[model samples]
Target chain A: MWAFTLRRLLYAVPVLLGVSMLVFALIHLAPGDVVDILVPPEVPKEIADSLRQRFHLDEQLYVQYVAWLGRLMVGDFGVSFFTGRPVAEELFGALGNTLVLALPAAVLGFLLGIALGALAAYNHGTWLDKLFSATAIIGVSLPHYWVGIVLVAIFAVVLNLLPAQGMGFEGLPTSWEHVQHLVLPVVTLSLIPMGVISRLVRANVLEILSQEFVGTLHAKGLFSRRVLYHTLKNAAPSALALMGLQFGYLLGGSILVETVFNWPGSGGLMNLAIFRRDVPVLSATIVVLAAIFVVINILVDVLQALLDPRMRR
Target chain B: MSQVLANLPRATEPVVSVEDLHVRFLLREATVAAINGVSFDLEAGQVLGILGESGSGKSVTLRSLMRLLPPARTRTEGRIRIAGHEITAMDETALRHVRGAKVAMIFQEPMVALDPVFTIGVQIAETIVRHEGISYSAANQRALELLEMVQIPSAARRLKSYPHEMSGGMRQRAMIALALSCRPTVLLADEPTTALDVTVQIQIILLLRQLQQELGMAVIFVTHDVGVAIEVADRIAVMYAGRFVEVGPTEKVIDTPAHPYTAALLTSTVLGSTFGRRLEAIPGTPPDLRALPAGCSFAPRCRHAQDRCRVHMPPEAVLAPGRITRCVRVADGELDLGSPNLSERSIAKP
Candidate 1:
C-alpha cells in the first residue's frame, strides 16, 4: 500500500509540472500586459521598462517559465504584482478561506448525497424515490450562481433572514458571524455536487442491491437493515471515489458561487487577480488547485484499493 | 374429518409442504405464470430432486418456499409450510426467524452466492449469530466446525479466507457450510452444482447426500441434469413448463416414467440404454409462460399429444401409492419408459 502511494506521488510530479507549464502559458497567452496594467500612462517609459525587467516580463516566455519553475521548486512564489505581497503568502491565505467554505460544503454534500441516494435506492420505484430523483435533477440542472442569486433574493433581500454575501462582518472571522454569512454560499456551492454524488450513489446502490451476494445475505435471514448495511458497504468504494472527485471539483470550481456571494476564497482572489492582471498569484493559485486535485484523485484511488479487495493488486 | 386427521401417521409428517403453488410475474409487457399449480411434500431426511430445463420454474418454486420473490412484481398464491409453520402467511419479521433457522438455501453460482468483501467465517458466523443469538466468538467456533463438517481442508485458517481466495469447489463447500450453519430442518439447494466442474459436481452431490443423512434435514435439490437428480434424489420430480409432469421414487420414475416428457428426458440422457444411437432431443423449446396453450404445456412437444391433450390440461394421475404423473396418455396406458438399466450405471454408488 505504501509502495502504491509512493508510486502515485512520483507519478504526480510530471502532472504538476505539466499543469504549471500549461497555466503559465495560458496566462501569458491572454491578451493583457501585466506591466502596462501596473504602471500608469503618466509613468515614464524607462520606469515601466525597468518594472518589466524587474519582474522578468521583458524576458522570453521560456526564460520566464524557467525562472518561475526555479522559484517554485524552492517554495518561493514571487510577489503579487498588484498587492506587493509574496504570492505564496497571499495564495495560502486565500486557500485557507476557500477551505473554510469548501470543507463544510463538501462534507455536507457527501453525507446528504449518500443518505438521499440510499433512501432513493431502498424505496426504489416508490414516490420517495421519484421525489429525490426529481430534486436531484433540478439540483444538477440549475447553475450555482443563479441558485445563489435566487437564494440571496429570497433569504437576504426579501426575508432578511441571513447575510447574503462575504465571509464575515468587516472580514473578521467569528464563529457565529461566519456561520451566518456561510449558509447561502455553502448551499449554492454544494447543490450541484450533492446532486451528482446522489445520482452516482443511487445507481451504484441499485446495482449492488441486485447482486447475487445481496440475495445470499437475504437467504441468510439477515434483517433488512443488515442487508442494507452490506449493500452499502459493497457500494461504498465507487461512491467514495465519486465523493473525492466531487470534493476536488468543489475546491477548484466553486468560483461562480464564490463570485456571486463575494466570499473571500481563492476563487474570488483568482477572479480579482485576473481582473487586475496579477499573473504570479493567478498562476500560483492554479498550480495549487491542480496539485490538490491530483492529490485527491490519488487518495481516492488508494481508498478504493483498500475498500475493494479485488483492487489490492 | 377430524377423526381422519387424527389417524394420519405422526412419523410421516412433511418438513416442507408446498400446496398448489402458483407464481405469476407481472411485468409491464406481460404477466408470466412461472409456477402453475405446483405441489409437493418433503419428508424429513429425504432428498427430493426437482429436475427441469431452464425457465421451468424450478428455482422459482424453491424461492417461493422462502417467500424470497419481489412482493410487488410477483403474485404468489400457495400454502408453503416449513415444519408445519405456514411460511406464506408469516410477515417479514416472522419469516426472518423461519429462514436460516427452520429453512436454509444454497444457490447455483457459489462465486457470487457469498459476499466478496466478507470472509467465509464472517458470513457463516453472521448467520449463526442472527439465528442462534450467540456471541461472535461462539459463532466463529461454530463456523470453523461447519467448515470441518463440509470437509474443507485447513478449516481453521479457511475461516479467514475471502470467497475469491477459495477454489470453485471450496467456495461451494463454504456456501453449503453456511446453509447448514443454522442447522435448518429443510435445506433448499437451487441447482447448487450447476456452476461446478463435472468432478466437483459429483463430490458436492455425494457431500450433500452424506450431510442430509447425517443432519436428517429434508433436502429439496433443484437441478437440470437428470443424471444428477437420479444420483442424489431418493424421489425425483420432473418439471416442464412450470409444472411437475412426473413425480415418484427415483427408481420408479426412471424405470417406469408415466409421463411422455419424463420418458423423453430419460432418453435424452447420454448415459441411457440407447447411448450408441442418435440421442432423442426434445423437439421444441418450453412454451412461453405468458402465451401457454390452454391444454397440456408439453402437448406441443409430446409425440403422443392427442387432440384432447391440445384442448385440456391433464390432471395428475396416481400410478401407485407414492407415484403420480401429469399426462393423459398415462390413463390410456400408451407411454412406455424404456429400460431400468438406462440410469443404473450413472447412479452414485452407495
Candidate 2:
C-alpha cells in the first residue's frame, strides 16, 4: 500500500507540471498587460519603455516564459502588479482565507446532508422524504451569489442578527474572528453541495434498500432502525464516491461564493487581479487552484483504492 | 417397513396448516390474484414440494405463509396457522418473533440473498442473535455449527468470507445455514437451487433433504423442476394459474395425474428437447390472472374441455387415500389415471 501511495505521489508531479503549463499559456494569451496597467497613461513614452524593460516586460514571450519557469523552479512566483508583493506570499494569505470559508462549509454540509439523506431514504414515500427532497431541489437550483445576497439582506441588514461583510469581531484573535465571519459565506456556498450530496446519498440508500440482502435482513427479524443503518453501511461506498467527486466541485464553486461575499479569499484576490490586469497574481492563483484540484483527485483515487481493494489490481 | 413408519416424526398435528389461503397483489393499474383458495398441510419432518410454472403463485403462496410479501402490493385473505398459531392475524412485532424462530426462508438466488458487505458468519450469527437474544460469541459458535452442518468446507475460514468471495454452491449452503441458525420448526425454500448448476442443484437438494430428516423440520420446497420435486418431495402440489390443478403423493401425482394441465406438464417435460425433437409441449401459457376465465382457469388450454368445463369451476375430487385432483373430467371418469411414474420408470442414457 505504501508503495502504491508513493507511485501515486510520483504520478502527481507530471500532472502538476501539465497544469502549470496550461495556466501559464492561457494567462499569457489573454488580452491584457500588467505593464500597461502599472504605468499611468500621462507618463512619457520613453519612461514607460524604461519601466517596461526594468520589469522585464520588454522581453519576448518565450524568453519571458523561460525566465518565469526558471523562477518557478526556484520557488519564486513573480510579484503582484498592484501590491508589488511576491505572488507566492499573497497566495499563502489568500489560500488561508479561502479555507476559512470552504473547509468548514464542506464539513458542515457533509454531516447535515448525510443525516438528512439517511432519514429521507428510510422514510421513503412519506412526508419527511418529500419535504427533505424538495428542500434539496430548491437549494441546488438557487445560485450561491443570490443566496448570499438574500442571507445578508435578511440577517445583516433587516434583522441585525449578524454582520454582513468582513471576518470576525474586531478585538478578538484572527482565527476566532475569521471563524465567526465564515458562517454566512460558508452556508451560502455549502447549500448547493449539501443538497446534491443528500440527494445522491438518498438515491443510493434507496436503491440498496430494495436489494435481496436487505430483504433477508428484514426476514431475519432485524429491527427497522437496525436494518436501515445496515443498508446505509452497505450503501456507503457509492455515497463516498459521490462525496469525493463533489468535494472537487465544491472547491471550484467556493470561488464564486467567496467573491460574492467579499470574504478576502483566493477568489476575492483573483477577482481584484482580473479587474487590475495583474497577470502574475492571476496566473499564480489559477495554478494554485488547479494544483489543489489535482491533489483532491489524487486523494479520491487513493480513498477508493483503500475502501475497495478490488480496484487496486 | 413398520419400524420405518413408527420412526417417522408424527405428533398427531401438522406443523403448518393453510386453509383457503388467497393472496392478491394490488398492482398499480389492476389487482392480480396470485393464489386462489390454496390449502395444504405440512407435517413435521415431511417435505412437501409445490411444482408449477413461473408466476403460477407457488412462490406467492409460500411467501404468504411467512407473510413476507411486499407490503404495498400484497394482501393475504385467509388463515395461515403455523405451529397452531394464527400467523396471518399477528402484528408485525409478533410476526417478527415467529418469523426466524418458528419459520425461516431460503431464497432462490443465494448470491443476492446474502448481504455483500458483511462476512457470512456475521449474517448467519445475526439471525440467531436477532430472534434468540443470544450473545455475539454464542451466536458465532452456533453459526459455525450451522455452516459445518451444511457441509461448507473450512467452516471457520468461510465464516470470515464475504458473500462475493464465495462460489454459487457455497453461497447457497451459507444461506441454508443462515435459515437453520435459529432452529426453526419449518424452512420455506423458494426455488433454492434454481440459479445453480445441475450438479450443484442435486448437491443442495440432497443436503436439504438430509438436514430436514436430521433436524426433523418440515420443509415446503418450492420449485419449477419436476425432477427435483420427485427427488425431495414426499407429496407434490401441482399448480397452474394461481390454483392447484392436482396434488397427492409424489409418486401418485407423477403417475396418475388427474388434471389435463398436470398431464400436459408431465408429458411436456422436454426430456430429449436438446436433440431438436420438439418433445410434446404444453399448448398455451398460463392465463393472466387479472382477466381469468369465469369458470376453470385451464379450460382455454385444455384439449379435453367441454362446454361445462368452460362454464363452471371444477372442485377437487378425492381420488383415493392421500390423493386429490382438481379436474371436471376426472369426476366424470372421462380420463383414466393408471399410468406409471415417468421419472421412476424412464431409463436415462448411459
Colliding residue pairs in candidate 2: none
Q: Point out the worst 10-residue segment of candidate 1 chain A by lDDT.
A: A169-178
Q: Write the per-residue lDDT of candidate 2 for residues A84-113, one digit (tens) a residue.
A: 899998887777766666677788777778
Cα RMSD of predicted structure 2:
3.9
What lDDT is obtained when candidate 1 is compared to the true structure? 0.86
Tens-place lDDT digits, model 1, residues B73-139: 9999989889879998998999998888889999999998899888899999999999989999999
Model 1 compared with the native: what TM-score? 0.93
Q: What is the DockQ of each candidate?
A: 0.68, 0.51
TM, every model: 0.93, 0.89
Candidate 1 lDDT tens digits, A12-126: 9999999998999999999868787888889999999999988988999999999999998898989999989999888887788878778888988888888888899889999
* TM-score of model 2 vs. true structure: 0.89
- For candidate 2, the per-residue lDDT at B316 reads 77
Reference-based lDDT, each prediction: 0.86, 0.81
Model 1, residue A295: distance off in Å is 2.0
